[model samples]
Target: MKKGIRRFGGYKFCFVAAVLAGIAFVIPAAWAEDGVTDSEVVIGQCAALEGPAAGLGTGMNVGMKACLDEVNAKGGVNGRKIKFIASNDGYEPDKTVDCTLNMIENEKVFALAGYVGTPTAKAALPIVQEMKVPLVGLYTGAGLLRNPVSRYIINIRASYDDETEALVERIVSDLGIKDIAVFYQDDSFGLAGLSGTEKALKKRGLKLAGMGTFARNTEAVKGGLASIMAAKPGAVVMVGPYKPIAAFVKEAKAAGFNPVLATISFVGTENLIKESGDAANGIIISQVVPSPDDTSIPVVRDFQAALKKSFPNEAPSYGRLEGYVTARVLATALEKAGAALTREGLIDAIESMSNADIGGMSVSFSKDNHQGLNKVYMTQVGGGKAKPVAKVARP
Candidate 1:
């Protein structure tokens, strides 16, 4: 049966008797004159809510709530209520493709939002293009999302190349470290970060001191740790998820080799801090989202308040901020796309984005550019918390 929009739930009026005379069983609600009915405006997302990258997914879910709650409180966009449908793809490429298909075909979502993982998101790219659904706020540093197939994808975070350049520049310029080593997983993600580091180093007349590879499933990373330690460099950069991060930290500390450990946003920093405790202190990582630890900021304060109200026991993390940013950017685009919120209208709205700040950072998009954020900020882990080190800037 089609649910009708009533004032409260009393069924005070008998207007339905007049409307029910028509052939169609479901009559449009009176408030839905502009096409935004009381049913729902559906949106979908797929993330690694299970498996290794689950922390990231959980965080994004929290942020998604923040956005939706805020939107619903204020009459929603175009009088349509936002209904978000999210699923877990287990951080696997093949699983992501299937999950995305289900979201599109079964759920009939208006667009894709807060999709996480580079490899996982990449698996669904062809479907996004084929179905003409807008993929918004993809949480990864992979450049493939922006290059070649930039039209359908709206990237909100800085790319791996941007983070790599900042990390390498800091290692070479500020730290005065020449012998830099890199340890990464043997996959497309690691390869992409490696390529960015190499390209950035080329501008400074230097090369990688050592390179080590580990499989994504490698829980015992002693071999990779030993390989990276053998280089005896002043700093070592890593491009892998949280499991290896903890393993490498434990093994490297045990080996009495504590080189400056830096990583792209993908090291699952929140999980590392939770597992490693004090060991996570002093470790540096790049971030594309605002620091949740810094609660003094107004945006962070409001986010915390909303999060506490909705999910009091749940802890805020990197993925939460990422998810919030994704929704904020998409809603901003939709607002600019006008009352007719179609996929093409969204693309055009995003393409015309300019100087719009979300909380702390300014996000912009252009006709030929879809990279929403170009600056990357450095963060240091200390006292079991991730703190922003320097202001975001062009790398």
Candidate 2:
């Protein structure tokens, strides 16, 4: 059954009906899980599809589709096709809660993947814990996500702590940069990077020369730019989406302030360049995933081929690579779960992976350690796109 869109609080949400629909069902030889019938296993996602962070959602969806298409064409994992349903949260915390509940209570998803932003994930965490739903490959490095130990969440990327630690060390050592300033989005996502940068700088017996903040979901960068430029630090670590980051860069360049600027992966790299135009030159960015253009790794080539096959017109990007990696990890776990394929079995299979190598990258997970990837890569804008520089030395 095709789902209809209904207006809610001046926003039209079209995923609600299809999320709860069960059609063309077949019975398994034995029982499995709530989402896993004989023919399909449903997965849910809550992403920012209609807001400042919309690009990230759309790009990830495309990559996920490519991976799924390949898997389903091969008869899927144990003959069960994968069904993905996504809802838009507009990058709002409150809406994240609503979408999460609808996915779990109404849609009965086996797991959730590619939930974007720290604030949105923060809002949805407690509910995930309460309901015991698996959360895989969320695109944030908030301290809360890595701390206090939630059994339901499996993190695929390096934490902001890891990224910031590596970045600060590189700036202090290789670039001989001091008097560093920080510009961040004013939310959990921003705070996570801020806290990481602070801790990393503290280890070197130094503190931030300056700090500035911008509101979530808005590209108001006048205040943040002015405050950071006032300090005149050798470099600044930006923590926000691409629009605000780009606005800050463009405005700061116009005002004749072009210091060494670096940003975390949450700041959509492609969008930043497009929005900032020529002003994006010489900017630094830390990435958790490898470049999609690097064909040396088999995974990169696979991702490029899948992207072209699934979305011939769309270009390969960091966002799509992240999504492709997440879907690949989930698919691997599902294969290990056997024909039974219970949610518990899936979790167990993932946890049991010991130093699993995925295309030149190492991933490991255990009952105690839920983090899969510990590596972070750095890139700098040389021409029109971000080019890989080197790997950040882990602290």
- The candidate scoring highest on TM-score is 2
| Alpha carbon lDDT of each predicted model | 0.76, 0.84
lDDT of 2 by residue, 322-378 (tens): 988888888888888888877778889989988877677778999888889988888
Q: How does model 1 score by TM-score?
A: 0.86
Model 1 error, position 70 (Å): 1.7
Candidate 2's C-alpha runs over 4 A off are 1-32, 391-395
The parts of candidate 1 lying over 4 Å away from their true place are 1-39, 295-298, 391-395
lDDT tens digits by residue: candidate 1, 200-305: 8888999888888887656667777778778787788888888777778777887788888888887777887887767777778898877876776656776777
Whole-model lDDT, model 2? 0.84
RMSD of each: 9.1, 6.3
TM-score per candidate, in order? 0.86, 0.90
